[model samples]
Target: MNFSGLLTLQKERVPLKSIEVELEVRDHVATVVSTLNYENKKNKPLEAVFVFPLPGDAAVCHFSAKIGQTQIVAEVKEKQKAHEEYDDALSSGQQAFLLEESDQSPDIFSLSVGSLPPGESASIRLEYVTELAVQADDGLRFCLPAVLNPPFNPQYKYRGRKCKSFEVVYVPASWLSYSLSFSARVSSPRPISKVESNCSLDPLQYLNTDQTQATVKLAAGHKFDRDVELLIYYKDAHQPTAVVEGGQASAEPGTLMGDPMVMVSLYPEFPETVMSSGTSCGEFVFLMDRSGSMDCAISKSEQEETRMSSARDAVLLLLKNLPMGCYFNIYSFGSSYEHIFPKSVEYSQETMEEALKKVNQMEADLGGSGMLEPLKHIYNQPCIPNHLRQLFVFTDGEVWDTKDVIDLVKKNSDSHRCFSFGIGEGTSSAPINGMAKEGGGHAQFITRSDRMQAKVMQLLRFALHPTVTVTWDLPKEVSVTVLSPPIAILFKGQRSLIYAQLTGQSSEAAEGCVTVKYSLAGHPSENQLHFSLRPAEDTGLTVHRLGARSLFRSLEREEREHKEHEDGGVKEKLVQLSVQSGVSSSFTAFIPVNKDNGDTIQGHFLRRNIPKPCEFTGRNFKW
Candidate 1:
């Protein structure tokens, strides 16, 4: 059958019935457990495939399914081998479940359940751990994806089973037939101040008198149309703290999981004298995506505000408010790239007007989103003297070659700092956040509900000054190793996370101190944080898993750098880490098997693609 016919048939028979989510936040890291219930309401046996979204940086640690009275556990295996096993099992009439990440985007995942008998139900549960991203307002943000709006990528192949050309029909949020139940428990060293959400939530419940622990849940009635976002605020949220977690007892000694670990949270606050200082000059490059998908409405209910128009408004705001005397240029890309000026020109009324005029006339006529050439062109330009170079990128983040773009940004990081903005719903978090991380800058998301002016102003304010660089000294006997990214740039009131393995043994009563020193506006400031050497009770290996994930990310970056010189060594190491830590990666997948010896059905079973409900208008959603 053709793709549309198949989609029509699948729409008539929805496989997913309900979803439940449980979350636990300890310090800065969050562990999410999601359960999806599926029923075969059809008269005959069938296979069901579902596609979903997740945070790009999440480390999926567990996947399992319960069929009837039997609970089947999934094991991590190489992606290709797992697919082969799944296909073989399906052909042999054995029940199987396969889960894998999307090759195009890091935030999308595909799950397939095979050989389900008639009138049977399967409850699949998955768990992942990820660090919470700090919002521009200094609140910790947690997002539960409710929509996976596919991006239009005519040039790229769609490897996932749900969509043929990245076209997802938008279903309104109020029209969801299935309900969702979500709850979260948050524990931190600081006092809990308040919890805010875009969706309605029950009253917060504190677990203790000090208010260090709290729990919150979605109210009884919530429409599952928009993504659920939680902005958590804490008393003294900017104050730094250090936590020590004990090693896992079941793991080998001296390894990453076997050793005790220390995590230090740094909130660098320079003196007022340093804060008042500002840079007099800088080079600003604005790169905007004018791809065809930018023509789509920013939200299903809001057809008037297209992504292209919003971006143009944002660019105009930026151009009008740029620092006087700074050099700036604008570039737009679709299938190809073009720049408004041949070279960086000083920010003046005339120059700003010229740029604004061109930007206003721009349209989403570009065929595809190819960012490499424009980036290469920007980097190849000579650096103007005494000007701090900052590159601001605005896009829906629809590119398929995410890794290559990130690697390019990482390679040119020393030349310029990058500030990225994701402009639409379901924008791939990989490129937006990845570029910021590699280029030593910040990432901001602008959705239909968000005000473009506020976010753009925030970026402008951040770009007005150079990022603060912080360094620290630890005890000599400790010999600590930093597992997370090194502190390259520090923004005031922004949280800096440092994860390290404490290798040497210390006395229980011993206290280790960390002194963070940084220079801002030519002034040197320092903050000292002292933590006890005693390890806290075992946290069920949460810290170890997070550390493993950090290690895996670093190793993957190194693998990309050594792609030409390496001989599969990095892949081997990645496999070992993934298998040992029980975390999913680009190289690994989760596959569950059902060994029940029921009578094998001789007839063929139909396949069904379960669609998630999202906001949609009468117009077909293209991207």
Candidate 2:
């Protein structure tokens, strides 16, 4: 995953689609945007940031690594005592922030460094191991401390996921081409447990050296309450963490620019079509929460908009995308049940537009959150023959208490499937994804307005699938090593359906026997997972899901892994892609976000924006 690309641009600032960084070892990675700091002790700080785009307008803010304090280790004792606040060693020189848990980005993290003493200089290089732990869906953000004024100022970009390490190596004018390469050296024989089991993954490497490592130890920890310090591991604790980015700057500095960012498109490693029951008789019920929180948005100002507005936009889009001959109903929850369609309407050309209007009619009630009651009422109803009931639930992913709704979904799991769409800045995809996984459906979110339509259409397509029970059997071993084994079904379902990716094995076995069992119509149908290493076959890799080169990458890895086998033909392709799209293939790899921005460096999610349009609707829900 070691990668280095040149970026030379003369612009003040630009919005990047993505960026990625790579390294040879599994060390944490750090990125910086180097610009001249003129004033002495100006407190000119910068931060990196990003977000996971959820379907239905839900967004989560996160930070990957953390800086506990900015106290510096000055070589001069007089200066250290004079700037005691900035020189405090307790949290000051203790500035190397590390990652706490494993996550995919557009989740946010920042690296903040203050102005140096006049004539003094410092450089930072992020480090992480190049292991299978890093995967697609992780991301990075580079942000400077913010000012109260317009601040689309100078910055850097990252591609999909960053490599092991990528940095803007700081150098003094005294030396030309005297840049330091961000490199890592990782070697260990045993596993190190940094994070606990499901709550989080362990650290990439153990802290054997004092200068290079900082550790956060927790005996009994609360997911949201636990805080640690480190650029890589500190911020990964509670899904996403927010930090103050870009400090108070009195004046704008000259911009430091780079080439346009580039992004690698990602596709689901699952079946493109929905598993159906043969005939298309389905009913969809959208349960939207128009409570107080829904009125929130990620505001540039303090009076941020609520989740309600975005939820309405997303639902209207869903209403417009309902398939023909489908029966659907839309409802809103606050203290009472407000039905948009009045009665369960049989979907058609005539009714779809009306439903859209109804969805648009919704506005935030500003009432407190109350969703359990609505779910309870919906679940108590009896079954409907020849109809697939899908509940598309929208909320800020919060209700204070959700067990009641979960119980209701559990009660109705046999006849109905619930697809959860989360919305808002505080919205958590984990709940919706959990609901979907429990009730045989999927979850998604919408982080911004522009992504609303595509996110909605993707959900509709996911619901429109012709079958259910999209299962595969791949010799268990072939299925074990997949880092994020996208269960060839999540392509059209919700959530990721990956199992595991096995390496150092057989190629034909990597392309082993896969039987897909699905029930679509009155006929109850199924398809076999027939994939091959041969490039010529239309394994649907290149044909179904937009037919993009990025989506169908397994073939290249398969071919390589087949050639490298000593058994003797297991090529590098299988194991190689574990860092690309395959399960466990994620590492800190760099990708360019836009054609104009420089190379981006974050974790993976920058490339795999959460709630990606047209991906699997069925996300795995294991909180």
Candidate 3:
């Protein structure tokens, strides 16, 4: 089950090695310039071409790249408004960065690798300008959308969904701690039913007590730090979700229920950051959910070993790829659990032999179990960066205390980013997504064992980002509407980020009034300072993705739950989303939507029923 069997090496090798994006904000619009470096690291010769998904509608300017004799570069000039929400990103998923919900429009876009000689690297640069339309709302409330495609809007998706993103130069300043806080202040107040906190989720819930604000006064030479959770949430009305508080409430159609204002708060202190006094190492934690139901046989498949075999192979492949300075621990759970190593085992000859010996002997036998316990243990466990703590939990869908475990992960953001790997028989994706989101982590679906290495390596590369911590600030006069949560910028790596779509405008638009905030290392006095924006061009992709990511995530949440219970409304919303993103989806595996628009492609995993608030009557979508 080594995933190499699945590889189809491209005989036509056009490799892109380096990518970069530069953004300049002027008035209400942002001028974006991008560069993609393509070079042959291969031992053979090749030719590559830049394949862009977007057509010439948005005013594009093409640049060229020369990697020795091979060259490729593409650019586009798009007009956008400052902060105007994009509800149409899904339709243009492969072309835009924001994963918004829209009628999927298929545009022929791609990149082809042509001629490349052995052992050579080339660089490419592209530049473009965008002026998005800005809408001013009285309330500081906005919805940051996400596409279940990347699980959020990534620059790339399942089948290479292209979106706007950036490449950054990460300069590591030793002893200097940096904090990154991003948010979308709603134009109106919105209520939040579920949130992560150190305290219990009770009526009188409180903020985090696990850590405290840094009392060390920061000066030019000071390196004091702590990690803070930058929460962008709506002001919620007193209402109960199905489980927490009091469980369940009715949403009267005419009754405008929850608050719409999404408050942006930097937790722990005014300026939040983290500084590690210890050396950084790479450590991997294998957290497996051994719930009893994972024993179920794959339907229509020849054997019951189908699921177990896949899970085992993936873990093994992961182990084989361990890099130097890497250490690992394995935890499996059913109603109870077992840790292969009481502590981490380095990638030494003896350690590897022993760990592999134990791994080979380990058996998959467990009852239905909970996820919270192991998560807590990992949080409390001692860890250092070189340890590179990565807990890869493989399960076959059975889970408990799902939300609670998610909260636990979020509360410990300073320590770990738990990547939830789900491989099961029709399990709901909501809880899994919630788990990753809570941990500020990532989630992936492993249906077959053959795809594990590529998937896992993708995660590894994502974790290898040079900028462990990064942040950006919106200028004065202009505001941005972040449409979605963070996604892989260039290729789903954490460093490549597209904030929720936000509006930008000149202060004069609101009779001249605006303030911007930035969380930095040395500047504490004017962190929440003011800036401005004026109108520019308007191709409208930014506005679209902002609205798209927000809407898509909500639908994805509902869709996963509907799948769990076999509801109908889930189908309807899914169809709508599929149409919006142009991806082929089923209740089974989801296909990448980059190739086709809504016209010819059709297959969806949408919800067929939308429970009328408190009542579970399942309303259907028009699709």
Candidate 4:
């Protein structure tokens, strides 16, 4: 059938009934469980496909389905094997479900429900764990994308033809055939200060007098047009804390999930004298995205500003606020790249005004998103004397060669620091965050309601701050094997997380101290946290799963970089860890089959593709 015909049929009989989400937050970590209900109304057995989005760093650990009284739990296995098993079960008249990550981006996923009999209902459950991002205001931020209302319509070529595009439709929460129910429970070592959200929410209810635990729910009749974001505030958020979790008993002793893991959160502080004295000398390079997608509005609002205009305004503000005598340049890229100056120029009134005029006149005339070549060009330039090079990148779309781009940044990290900004909804977070992390910089996202100038200015402050170094000190008896990469960038009041595996043993009453030493602007400073050596009880394998994910990403990057020299060892390690920890990875998928042979029907099933809501734009997307 044609794409338009499929969409029309989808509108006539929507299979989705409701979505229920439960979130549990422990300090900086959050665990989410979501249940999706679907019922078939047609007279024939059908297979349904639904594509959705998740947090880029999340680890999906569990997936299962319930059909009537029968329950089937999914297991992580090799991607090819999972696909074969799913097909085999479908052909045998058994119900099956397959969940796999997208090859183009980590944030997107595709789920397939096969052999769903007519008039039958199925419930799908998915669980994931993610670290809450520290916001500019010290509030931990969590977002649930509104995938049903406007839908997440990612553009991809099907059978050499472009799929029909649909305008953004605003379906009110009350008007949607599918309903959403959300509730969250938060617990922290520090006292909870407050909870806030963009959507309407019920009043916060504290579970104890100390205010360390609380519960909140989304208010009824809330709109699903925009993502549901939660910002949780805590008293004394800068205090360093450590959480130690024991490993899984079922896994091998030497495996990642079987060992003890500790997560340390640090917020570095500089001396007052150094903090007040901001550096004035630096080389600033700003890169802007001029792809066609930038022409779309920043949000779904009727009068919202376009992403291009917002980025242009932010660049103008940066130009105006730049420190005098600093070296700077401006570059724009789409399929091709253009630079205003041949090389870095000293910042002055003449240069600032020249850059501003050109930025204001810039438009989104470029055809596709191609960032690697321009980034390579920028890195190829030699650094100016006595001026630390600081790179700023702005984009509203995804690029196919994300790993290559990140690897390039890592190769040139010693000469410069990179700051990245993702503009508009549905922007891929993998590349935006990856480039920043690899380049020793910070990443920012600008949503529909965010003012680009404010975030840009905040990052500018970080750029002007003196570069800092980090050293970790632990007890002599207990050594730590850091799972995450070395600390590359540090900013005042921003949280830096470190995951480590602790070996050896200490007495239950003994205290273990960890210190972070750094030199800020030629002055040495340190922050330390002392906690009991005994691992905490009743804490699930959250730390282990997160650590596994960190290691998986590191290995994946290494595998990509050494594709010529390496054998299949790296891929094997990744698959082993993913299957052992029950976490989803690029090499593995979650597949579960209901093998119940009772009352098997012997007919072929029809395939039906469920249409997901697309954003309100017509930009062509590449996979």
The prediction achieving the highest TM-score against the true structure is: 4
Q: What is the lDDT of candidate 3?
A: 0.37
Give me candidate 3's TM-score against the actual structure.
0.38
Q: Which pairs in model 1 have colliding backbones? A: 171-614, 173-225
Work out candidate 2's RMSD over C-alphas: 21.0
- State the weakest 10-residue window (summed lDDT) of model 1: 1-10
TM-score of candidate 1 to 2 decimals: 0.87
Total clashes in model 4, counting residue pairs 3 or more apart in sequence or in different chains: 3
After TM-score superposition, what is the CA distance of residue 588 in candidate 1 from its true location, in Å?
2.3
lDDT of 3 by residue, 1-623 (tens): 00100011232324443334443322122334555554465686543333332211111223344455433332211112101222232343212111111122111122222234567665544433222211111011111111000011111111112111111121233422222122111111123222221112223222233211111111233111111111112232211111001101242221111101111212112111221222335778888754434443322122344445556666777777676677888887765678888887777767766766766655444533556677777777899654546667676544565445655665675566676665642333445555655555666654434445666665554343222222335445334443345332111222112333233332443322222333223232222312122222322233232233344444555665566788868666655543343222222112112222322112211211111101112352111
Q: Give the higher-TM-score candidate: 3 or 4.
A: 4
Question: Which one wins on lDDT?
Answer: 4
**Candidate 4's C-alpha lDDT?**
0.73
Q: What is the lDDT of residue 57 in candidate 1?
A: 75
lDDT of 4 by residue, 28-92 (tens): 98889988887877798766554556777888998777776667777788987776555555567
lDDT (0 to 1) per candidate: 0.73, 0.37, 0.37, 0.73
Task: For each candidate, give its TM-score against the true structure.
Answer: 0.87, 0.41, 0.38, 0.88
Error of 1 at 359 (Å): 1.7
lDDT of 1 by residue, 410-440 (tens): 9998888898988876566778888887887
Candidate 2 structure quality by residue, lDDT tens digits, 1-623: 10111101211111221122222211221222121111222243222222112211111111222122222221111111222223222233222221111132211222223223333323222322111111112221111212101121211222222111111222222322122111222211112223232223334445565323333222232222111111232232212111101111231221000011111111223333434433445788888876544554522222344466677777777666666777888878764567765457788877887777677777655244567777776776554566778788888664534434554565577777777776633344435654775576655554445545665666666544434343334444333222221332323423232322222223443444334454443345455544432122211111111111222233433443455554323323433332222122112222212123321222212111122111112341111
Residue 440 displacement (Å), model 1: 0.8
